[model samples]
Each structure stands twice: as C-alpha cells, then as structure tokens.
Target: MSKVDVYDVHLVETVASTTDVKPLPLATIDIRVPLPDELIHLSLEEQDSLERHIVRKMDRRLMPIIIVMFWLNILDRNSIANAKIAGLPKDLNMNNAQYNTCLLIFYVGYVITQLPSNAILPMVRPSIYIPLVTCAWGLMSMAQGFLHDFQSIMVVRFFIGVLEGPFFPGVIFLLSCWYKKEELIKRIAFLYAGNILSSCFGGLIAAGIIGGMEGVAGYAAWRWLFIIEGLVTVAVGILAMFLFPDYPRTTRWLTKEEGLFAEWRLSNEVAGIIDEDSSGIWWGVSEALRDPLTYLFTFMQMMLTTGQSFTYFLPSIIKTLGYNNTITLLLTAPPYAVAFLGSVALAYSSSKRKEFCMHICFPLTISVIGNILAMIVHGTGARYFAIFLMAFGVYVVYNVNYAWVSSSIPRPQAKRAASLAIINLMSGGATHFYTSYLFPDNDAPRYYMGGSALTVAVFLCAMTAITIRFYLARLNKKIDAAGGDAEAALRANKGHTETMKAFRYQLHWWTWPLPKALGTEVISIYHTSSKSADAAKIGKSNFIATSTEKWAEKHSRTLETILCTFFKNGTQLEEYILMLDVGGIMVYVEIPESALPPLPPGLITGNNFAPRESNTASKKEVLQMFKLKTDQKIKSWVEEVPMENCIEAVEKL
Candidate 1:
C-alpha cells in the first residue's frame, strides 16, 4: 500500500500600517495536496525514540542466532589444517602436493562462482538460498572422510567451495540492509572473528577427537571429525532456514510499525530516501559499478587477503616444527587464540571510530613487520614469535576489511549484492594463485617464499587503505559543493526581487505586508495548471505543474491578484512558498487571533497552520487567508476589487 503526504503551509503576519491599503491578517496557507508518503507518520523525535527500541529488539532477537551458526560453520570447514596433521593425508593416500592441489581447486570453484551466485540469491528466497547452500557444503565436507584418493577429495572440495560462495557475501549484504554503516562494522567483525576463533579451536577440537575417538565405528579419528562436523553443519543449516530472518520487508516477526520504521530509518540514514521499491540482490552490484569507491574497496580487500594467506595454511606450517600429529594440532590453537584477540580489538576500534583505512592500515603494517622478521630469523625461539605475529597481524586487517565492505556500498539492491560478490570472488581467485603457491612443501622448515609474499601483500594492503581514505574524503567534498550550488540559486532569486522592486505590482486584496527588519521581499514561484484564482476557495480544481517555466511566465500577472509568500523561519521555507510580483511594496495587517478558526487536534502552532477559511467560507475570511506577509508592516487595511483574471490585471497595470 501507498500513502499520501499532506504538506500544509503556515502563515503569520504582524500588521504595520492600517491605513487605506489594509491587507487583512493572512492567518495561514494550508494546501492539502497529496504526495507519495515515503516515511512513517511520526515526527523526527518519535522516530528516533522508536528506532532505539527496535534496534535493541533486533539485536537481541537476531544477533545471537547468526553469530553462533556462523561460528560453527567457520570452525568445521576451516579445520582442514588440523586434519592434515592428524594423518588423514597419509591414510587417504594424499601426498603433500596433492593436498595443496585439493585446497587450490576448492578456491578455483569458489572464486569463479562468487559473483553469479550472489546476483541470483533473491530469486531463490534468501532464507532458502543461504541454508540450502550451507547444507550442500556441509554434505560435501562430511564426505571427505570416505574419500580414498586425491581425485575424489579434490572433487568434493571443489564442490564444497562452490556451495559456500554465498555464505559470507550473503550475510554481509544482509547486515548492510539491516544496520547503518557505523553500526554494521562491529557486527561484520564479530562474524569475521569467527574465522580467527576457528583457527584457534580447530586444533583443540581435533586434538580431543583424534585422541579419544580415533577408532570409533572402525573409522579413523580424522574421519570421525569430518563426519561429525559435516552432519552438524547440515543439521544447523536446516534449522537456520527456520531461524534466519529474510529480507527486511518480508520478515513476519516484526510488527507493521516496526517494519516500516526499520525500512525508513535505514533509508534515511543511507540514501536520505526510503527505497521500499528496491530489491535485495543485484542492487549492491549495480551500485558497485556506478560507485568509484568499489574499486578502492577492491584494492583494500585484495591486499588484506594476500596477507591473510598465512592463517590458511597455519597448521601445515606448524607441522613442520616436528611435533607429533596431536601435539602439532594442539600447538596450533595458541597462535590462533592470539590472532582472535588481535582481530576483535581491531574490529572494535575500527567500528567505534568508523575509520576503516587507519584501522586496516595499522594492522597491515604490523603484519609486514612480522613477515619480515619471520624471513630474517632462524632460531626456534625467534621464529616462533614471528609465527604468532603472522596470525595476529594478518587477522586484524582481515577482520576490519569485511566490516568496511558491508558498510561502504549502500542501495539499489542489485549492485550491493554484486559488489559484495565481486569483492569476495576476487579474494578467492587470488587465493588460488598467489596464496596456494606460497606454501609449496619445498620451502619446508623455513617457508621463505610464504613469509616474503605475505610481507609484500601487507605493504600493498596498507597503501591501498591510505588511498581509499583520501578518495572518500574527496567524494564528500563534491557533495558539499553541490549543496552550495542549490543555496546560491535560491539567493540569486531573492536578489532579483530586491533589485527589481519598481517592476513588482500587488493586487490590493491579496497582497500582504513585510516586516521592516526582514529586508527585501523575495518569493519562489510554481506553475499550477488550474485556472481558478482561489484554488484554495470552496471546491475549486487544484493545479499541477505542466511545464514549470512556461506556466510561471503565463500565470505571472494573475498571480499578482492571488499569490503572496514569506519565510516562516528565516529562509528555510524559500523552497516551498511560490509567489508572484505585483508592486514590490505590499502591506499586511494581522487580525486578532480570536478571528481565526480553531486548530485541529494533531496540529502544532508554527508547524501546522489552520487556514482561516474552508469550503463555503466567508469572502472576508477567504481574502484574509490569501494575504501573505513580506518585509514591512502594513500601515492600513483595504479591500480592493478582485480582478477575474491576470490578463485584465496586466492591462490595468
């Protein structure tokens, strides 16, 4: 359903002269015309009150559900490192090179399909699409336990990557629509932090499973971990279908008022207009293409991902330390724990300040330092500290960038979806190339190539963040300049009236007085289609603009007989009140308040006006209501003859 907006004008006048040219009090200008209603009926203050309430409600109802499910998903899928150390590769006949190939293949499919899947998501229902995707990936991951050869494992992993493409992008888009940019960063960080937490706990969980459940059901402990974790993922995915919130407009749990407020609040915060007309998927993508910021965003994300490759193979890197399979897996948890702490702190700082470039750049610099240290050091003690730094430095930036993307591109639903997909896909595609190559077994005990590549990636990431920071600042400057242009146009119109005062003429009955202090009288004009002088008179036809300039020129003379204008609160109303010039000098007399009609219940003085006359009202009230105020007070009041049309007035003048 649609609503119509009623914009009423309120007029107040102070009579200066009550002599021969008496312009009676113009108590109000209330035009009850219809416009599309795009917001809730509440005032700004009410909306703010309700917004705070709804925000809390949504956070409580939705945040925990999304966080836990995402946390579980990250833990299960990302623990491939743990499995590698647990002897699964040997038992499954997988060589180190073949394992790398399987990992790379997963990303190959994951990277290629990211954009297309995100684009089509809304077509499949978000609730259905996300859960279905999750379940499919989970099933494939579980099947890893049964694979006996490299070919089978690679196929499963590839399919897993394809199905998982939408999870991060989809959730990011969801958060973008639900929260304002500043409010969304921490949430995105919370979600990304799950990846770090997974890194920390994957080994701990794997350690227990491998030690206690190795021979359960005649299956190896690694296989048990795969099957158990995979089945859990499938179950959670199914449950998520029931628990997940769909598109904001379609969510049934919210009240009608709540939903409308939610939609309008976000729209006001982001676009300054509500887009109930928009869609959820490709809007992000389309916005991405048109928005120059997306490219800068792409650069930031690419750099962060490059530095992040270290966490991806962290378990394998640890196994080279010569610990037994269980101990290596156990040892993996501590560095990940440190990384998790680093990421959460960085995310919190970035979100709180809404300063993405600084937060991301700082951590990336640290990662670069860590990578360099790792490259130069060889001692077990020194090298171990570098290893911890690798996770800590990389995770901080990775966590911050996800939040940044979710916040940056807003609206035209398709473009947002596309932008997120493109960013994610690019990151995945890079993983297949640079990230996979960094960990060749030949590097062995040192892994010099991996460390150096990470160092370069960190440096590049920092540079990209700095560049984007400046770009956003420049765009803001352009927006300010555009606003200034609009203000200048209004001021120019006001100056025209001041300079051309002698040419202005006023019909005695309609013209009102201006206060002495307010300077020269200036009013804007609108072209109306209706020919009636008192469109505000009893049951007269209303006017709509045909061609604004042509209508303005045509109606200029008659408008002197009918129209007048003044600023209610300085120049703020200059945009709304349309006027015509008769003579520059006009007099307005304020009538007693008792003479005006009572105001309506919802009306507020100064904000909502009560027009003195209505349908079939007295002619005196009609004339009084039409009189507008200007710069000087009227010394006298007069009821001059009303001309039938502007043509007659032009001839008389």
Candidate 2:
C-alpha cells in the first residue's frame, strides 16, 4: 500500500479506538521545513529592517516622555538650590549647616527607597508607578511653598526625596530594557540631557519667578519658584501616565510582531536572559551583593558623584565670579549648556565606536585638570573657562558611568535593576551628605578645599574605571578559553544561553570589533525514530554538508527549480519552521509525506507503521521522542550529498 493510504487507515483506526483522546491539532505543532537560501537571506534581511524600525519607533515614543519626566524631576528636586539663592534660607531661618542638613535629609529618604522601588518595578506597571510617584513628589515639592520653618521645609524635602528616589534609577532600568548594550549609552545621554537642560534653564526660570513674583499674592519669590515648578511637574506627571511605554514585553503600543522581534533581538544579544519575573528580584539582589564588581563600581560612582556635586552649589560657585543673583543664575546656564553639547558628543562617539573606557578616562582626566585650574588660576576669564571644563568633565563622566553600569551588568534583569538603584542611592546619598560639607559658606571665592577634594575624587574615579576595564578583560579571556565549557562559564555567572558561547566583554581601551571578532556559531541537529520510513531509506547514511557560500548557491538553485516544477499553482508550505544555525550554515529539511513520491522497494510504507497508544504517549513523552530524533539527526549527519537531488526528493516527499 502507498504511504498515504496506510496513513489514512491508521488515522481512522486511531480515531475509532480513542474515545476521549483527540488527534493533535496542526496549529499546536510547529512544523519544521527547509527554505530556499534566497528566502532565508530575505527573511534575515527583513528581520534586521524590522529591528531598526522598532528601535526608531521606541526612541520616538519613549525618549521624549522620559526626557520630559526627568526634566521635571530634576527641576523639582534641584529647584531648592535656586530657591536657596532666591532667599529660601533667610525666609526659613536656616543656617548654612541647617541647609546642608536639609540636603542630607532628602537623600536619607532617597537612599533608603531605591533598591526596594526598583525591585518592585517589574510587578507594578511603570505607567502607574512612575507617574504616581511623580505626582506625589510634585505635590510634596509644591508643599515646600507652604513651609513655615526649617523643620517644615525639611519634612517636605524628605517626602519629595522619597517619592523622587525611584525616578532616575527607574528610568535607567527602563531604558536598559528597551535598548541593546551598543545602543544604550546614547539614549542614556539624551535622557540626562534633560537634567542638564533643566539645570541651565532652571536658573533662568527661577530668575524670572524670583524677580517678577517676589511678593505676588503675599508669597516669597522662592515660594513662587517651588509652587510654579511643582505645579508644572504635577501636570507633566499626569501626562506621563498616558505617554510612557512600559516594559517592552508588556507594552501595548507595539504590534505583536514588533514585540516578539524586540524580545527576540534582546534575547539573542544577551543569550536569552531576560528579567521579567518578580520571584527573581531577591535572587538578583543577592547576586549583585555577591559580585565584587558591584562594590568596586559603587565606590567609583560615589567618587564621580562627589566630583559632580558641583551642580548643587553651582550658583554659589558662580556667585564668586562677582555676579549678583540673576547674573549668577545666568552664568550657571552656560557651563551646563556647554556640558550638554559635550555629553552628547561623547556619548555618540562612544556608541559609534562601541568603546566605553577611553570615553570615561578622557573626560575624567580633563575634569581633574579643570579642578586644578579652578584652584590656582587667577584671571576671571581663565577661571570661567575652568568652570566650563569642570562642568563638561563631571557631567560626561556621570553620563558614561551610568551607561557602563547598565551594560556591564547585563543579565538577570532584576539584578541589574537592583544594582543600578543601589549604586545610585549609595553614590548620590554620600555625595549629598558629605559633599555638602565640602563647600561651606566660609569657603566662598575659590573653594580650594572643594576643588582639591574633587580632583582626588575624579582621579580615583579614573583609576576605578581602569580597574573595571581590566576585570572585564580577564573575564573575556576566560570565556574565550572555555571552548565547549563556554556555557558552563556563562552558567557560573547565572546567565548562560545558547548564543553566548561567542560573548566577550567590552573593554575600555580595546580596539577590536569584539562582536565581529568573536563571531556566531550554531549547530543544527535533526533526528527521527529508527522505525520511520525516512530513517529506513537513509539507514545511517550521512546527509549533505557544505560551506555557507557554496551551500547557499547550491540550495538556492535546487529549491528554485523544485518549486518552479511542483508548486506552479502557487501553493506553498503553510506550517514550517526556519532554524538558523549561525556560524557554519547547515540546512536540515524534514519533508512531509504529501510532498514526496512513492517509496522505493526496500523502504516499508505506513502500512507497517503503528500509532503509539494515546495513553502511553503523554505530551512529555512525545516531546522527548521528538527531541531524541533531532539529537540522532545531529549526530548522524556527517557526509555530503548532491544538493539538487536532495531538494528534488524533498519536494516529492
């Protein structure tokens, strides 16, 4: 009997014998089939184009929302400094120490909440969590306008900190979820540009509010600053709820195909490690705590934050340039504006070259020089130029360092989230608390002590960056040497994946194109049971194997000719799977019976076949059987065959 006849008879008998069990649905099974080489290439090209389109769409939809939110966040948080210059201290009866204490107190709430907030981020929708906190902080910021004394303002600031704490780290975590490592730094820089622009324009805005509204409606100018900025923040927060895209996996804005592609691309980049589950949050935290690099990076960030603390006392620093309230605030604008431009330039260069270390080292070294010049330079022009250097260096370092943390710790999403929060909390808290004391009211004209301290911090940050570069280098070497144990090496780090064998660390000064150099290798294994007709026909004979170029050429013609002859009516395979084994290209075709011609004399038709009992064939057992067959194919396929004939036979199967 023919195979089709035998299969039909077996199907009828199987249906009659099984009272409850139903035949497997075609939709439930993923049918694997071979495609023409040209089609495969076209699919890959289409996927690449799709990825670029998705990334662009994400940037358009997500970037502006985060930037605006961050702008409001920075404005609300640091408006206190502007308010301080506009008479907050005098109005509130705050001594320099009390003011510093207020800054420290805000960080007290800020520091305590970061880790927990980031840990909880995956469980709650960001659309809800982020805006809710934003609105809360805005309300708190506005409440600062009603403060009666040091204690009242301090309490308001504390709540503002608590509500504001999750934002920066949360945004960083959010960006990391959407962007690949190579594409991350630029996005981070753009997000931080909002912070820089706010600093620049915050002063200008504060100047306007303070100058024009000093006593409007019986409210102080500083009060007007807080109230206006806070209300603006609240309005923006409400808008954020409607604008912000949640995690890529769950975001509703993306089409289903785009979402899958986003997930697939990210999985491929990180070897299939994605952090989606809340159950892994604590585990991620533990992993972060156990990694020594976490502590090292934390220390480095602390020093960088200390050097960058100049932002808080910027008006004071510029006031020494012999400028009044409005002029000092205006002067503060230029340095940050210049730094904004510098940051974008540096971040773009880093992303393009795929280099992280030198970008950091170069700016930090320049910042140290700027600090030294600020301490010793006598001329006003030279001093102002020094401020420019200081701003550019510190801001660039801050931007790059944040990106570094995100890229270096690429694994278990929860751990990355926790690590970012912990690093930001520790670094920012220490800087706010301790660096506040560095520039007391007594050290006005040239805060030589502050400059010197910043010099040391910048220098230490550079050293730490070098240390991290070296550490990554060592890990990359170990990964390279792992050979078949590469997966084991990745597992040791808790992020092993099929695509990770070629992974390498991005080192600071390394000039190699790491991704291209490492290359991708894939192994395809095809398997079938010994009792199968195809298995009997082939008997242990190896199938075709060839180089990618030759195979592509050979199979391209074969598939083209076969389809032209057999599929002239435009019929095509409906259920098929395309598997790409990357490095050495190999195509394994599993032909369906309908596509083949009658069997030869030696091969038994389906009449000799027996359907496995439904009770015995549990889903798990069936899956195992399929896996065993695939494994056998992988092991047995060791010889080459005529590509044209194989294609013809597969088309006739």
Candidate 3:
C-alpha cells in the first residue's frame, strides 16, 4: 500500500510482466507465520545478527541438555563393556559367549523400536517423548544392577536397548527439524560428540566407580557402576522435559519475533513448511521405500558401522598392548578425545562450507590406511596410532551420514523419520549381531581376521561415499538440463510426470568439470488455494493468484510475445516456471546491458513480491527473501510490479 522507490535499488531488473517461478505444491504452504515489521525494515546485517542470536540462544539452551542426555545414552550403552572388565562376567557366572549375547540382545530391542518411536515423535511433544524414553532406558539400566544371572542380565540388556533404541535416530530427526541442511552437520557433530566424549569420559567415570565402589555396598563394583550411571541418566531425563524444545512454533520461551524468524528461516530454507505431515506414517514409509537414495545411504551406514566395530572391543584391544584392565580403560580416553576434536573440526568445515563428500570420503580413506597398518604393523606405538585413525574415520561418518540422510531425503517429516529408522535398523541394529563376534579375545592383539574384515568394510565405505558424491553431482546436472523442477526430478521414481524443470541439488560440489552457464532464472510466486481466505488478500481481484495461470495458459500467443521481449539484442531467455502463491508471482528474464536506464511511465514499487510484512517492500527485500529461502539458489530476481495499482501498468505492457 506504500511506494517503494527503485531508482537506487540495484536488484530490480526492468521486467514488464511475470516470468518463471519455482514449483511450489499446494501442500507445502502455511500462512500463519507472516513476516514481522521490525524484521522487514532491518538491513541485511541486522537480520543476520538476529539469526545468529536465535541460533546462539537455541544452542545454549538446547545442546547442553541434548549432550547430557546422549552422554547418558552412550554411557549406559557401553556400561556393559566397562562392567565386563570389572568382573561382571565372573560375578554373573558368564563366559564370553553370554556377554556377546547380551550385547546382541540390546541392539535387537534398540533397532526394532526405532522406526515406530520416530514415527510417534511427530505426534507427541518432543520435550515429553524424548525424555520419557530416556527415563525408561534409565530404569532398565538400573535394573541391570539387581540381576542375578546371565539370563536376567540379558533380559535387562534387551529392554535397555529397546528403551535406548530411539535416542540417536530420534535425535537426528529432531536436529533436522530445527536446523537447515547447511546447519545440520555441525549441530549433529556436537550431538555425536556426546557419544564420542562419553567414551572418553565414561571410561574414566566407570573406572572410578568400578574401582572405588566395589566393597562399599557389599555388592560387585560392576553393579555399582550400573546403579550410579542409571541414576545420573534418570536425573538428566527428568530435567530434559523442562529444558528441551519441541518445534519452534510450539516452544514457549521464544519471543513472538524470535518464534516468527525461527519458523520463517526453516520455511525459507526448504521453500516449504517442514512441519508435521497430514499424511500417515506409512505413506512416509512408502515414500522412503521408493527413494533410491534411501538404500544407498543405508549401505553406507552399514559399512561405516561394521568398519567401526572396534569400539565394542577397544578396551580389550588396548589391554592387548601390555596394559592391565584399569590402565586399558584409561587409555581408551585419548583416542576418543582426538576423534572428538577431529569430528567437531570436520563438522564445522562441512557446515561452514556446506560440503560433505570430501569431508566424509577423505577421512574414510585415512581410516583405510589405518586399518591396513593395523593388519601388518607389529610395534605397539604404531598399533595404537592406527587405532586412533580407525576410531576417527567411522564416527565422523556417523554424524555426517545422518545429516546427509536428513538433507537428501528431506520432507514428509514421516519419510525422514522412517528413512532414518529403516537405515539404522540394518546398520546400527542387525550388523551388531555379527560384529559382536568379529573380535573374540581369541583373535586379540593381531586379530588379523577381524582387522581384515574391518579394512575391507572401511575401503568399501570410502568408495561408496565417492560413488554417492559423483552420483549426486550427475543428478544436479540432469536436473539443470531438465530445467528447475527439483520437486519432479526427485520424485521421478514415484510416477510423477517428467518436465523440463529441475532443481539444483546442493549438498556437495566437487570440482567436476561442469559446463559454463547458459543463463536461466526462475521466480516462484506461491499463493494459497482459492478456497483459503489468504487467496483473496494476495492481490486485488486475485488476478495473479487465481487467474494468472489461466490467463497464461489460455493466451499462448500473448505469452510467446512476452517471451520474445527478452530474446532481444542477441541475449536469450532459457526457461522458467510461473508458480503463484500467497506472496506474488515471480517472472524470470535476463536484462540486457542496454536495458538499465530510464524509469517506466508509471511505476510505484512492486506487488506480490517475496514474503513481507507489508507490500511496501523493495526488490532487494524480495531477493533477500529468496536468498534466505533458497540459500541463494535464486540469487538474482526480476521485480514484480511494485503495487496493486501497478497491475494496470503491467497489463498495459
């Protein structure tokens, strides 16, 4: 309703009519999160600062509790290993076979429940759901303290697995809910750091409890270990419900402005609302079952898990290096510490640069070297160093792969949820049953059979990662060749129609020799359906919303003539989409160098441009909106007419 002068704005090109836009399905639109005025008027720097502040607050409040909960998660998971070294087998009258069974049993429960647990997460408040599960596992861990036989302990371990099953996959899904694809790996690194650091510190804590608390309660030190760790976990779980946030919209602590930005930032990232799915969980499962990426990612996870099976036996491995049990436990800390630093560093780089393949593949290649060295090397120091490398490679993949799964298969929160569970089901769950036997003490020290299997797994893991990187790169080029409908190209496996439009898949970009640019631009204007109240408010008469598509469809000659306008002076127009949404329709055209000057006869800003609090918005604002939404995929924008009054002016063109 106000004039936005463009004499000084560098962004708006002199386009007379609507051009092409991104394809936005009707299901993805949500109008409740309108742009805030204070935010609307700020310089880009101020907006960036506000975004950083929101992330900072979210991290401060969210990460520590997540870290602690996961810390307890892993601490409880590995408690059995620490218990084994502290006379758990001797006291419980069990052999190595029984101990391995216990290990396998827990994972059985853990894997089985994950798909269902993640499916339920969206239906419940995460604050309540995550905590409730954490507490259930805590109770199961405490029960491990009272068990009298291998049978009882195995039963307890299975329940512990069931209770703990959802934690990691669920955490991956939860983190994806809050972060952008670019922001995901770094946050996930911090999340996995809980698992990594627990190995470092959990060893120290278990060593202390097992060594000190043995005789105090007239109970085995191993029992004291379980009892104490379980108590700490229960306490942390209770605090989590109060500390953790659910989705941004439902969270209580954010200011209205903060809440709006939180929602907008993510909505802007996906070019759609990624909230709950109206469809059932099975539909998501079907979507996941059909995506080729799901199987590829699952295989990668399986290799990574099998490659890192040494984690279950690191204590025994170090003990073989001439240390006693206690010293062996202490030695486990250093490698994990190094892995933690490496992981956090890699995660930061991956997130900052928004690249994953090299970050992932290169480390795994190093692991291959480490695995080879372990197989042939005879010296103690060299063996220990190889162990460090082995530990580093797989855990790093653990975080990166989860982030990749979330990013690559993103959407239908249900599909994302199901995909992760289905993946972990094989890699984290079923693989454990076999990996548990790979390092039987009979193969200790050299354990060439175990080391050999692990080496191939690591090598295959690296090659598979490289394969995926190139496959994705090829797909990006194909989508470009097809135009810009990433939505259709990605869903091609699901019987969706193929069109000339494609989306650039942005995860990692290798220096693959891509062809030089033939210019193409797209502008998507997303308007609510006509049945919605917001449709009437999109523009006066809703011409751009309800009838623009029809007009364009009906008037082929008029559209062809309009297209002819930009094919002037030897410059060309490649292709574009005209998607109308609650905002405005976006038109794509390349302005020739000669088209730069002279105001049109009647211009008073633009209408139905990017999401804004007021139509008093600028071209710069619209481009900024796209920059935030597409992560700069739609970097350059042609302006829509500035006001509804200009609708007449646009028609005159």
Model-by-model lDDT, in order?
0.60, 0.68, 0.67
Candidate 2, residues 1-653: lDDT per residue as tens digits?
A: 01100100011000010111122211011221233233333343365477789999998999998899999988888888888888889988999999888888899888878889998887789988999899999999999999889988888888888899999988898888889877788889898889889999998998888878988999999998989999988999999899888877689899867776776666556544555545467887886787667887899999988888878888888878887898878888888898899999998888665677788889998899999999899888999999999988888767777888888776667778878888988997756788877888888778988999999999999899999888776565455446323466656655333224334556532221111112211111121121233322312122222213333333221110000111111122211001111111111122232443333432223123221211222223444444665687533222344876888756764
What C-alpha lDDT, on a 0 to 100 scale, does residue 53 get in candidate 2?
93
lDDT of 3 by residue, 598-622 (tens): 3333221322333212112233443
Clash numbers, per candidate: 44, 8, 27
Residues forming the 10-long window of minimal summed lDDT in candidate 3: 1-10
**lDDT of residue 78 for candidate 3:** 90
Count of clashing pairs, candidate 1:
44
Q: Which ranges in model 2 have alpha carbons more than 4 Å from their true place?
A: 1-42, 484-487, 490-501, 508-653
Runs off by more than 4 Å, candidate 3: 1-49, 493-503, 509-653
Ranking by lDDT: 2, 3, 1
RMSD of each: 16.9, 14.8, 13.6
**How close is every model to the real structure, measured as TM-score?**
0.68, 0.72, 0.73
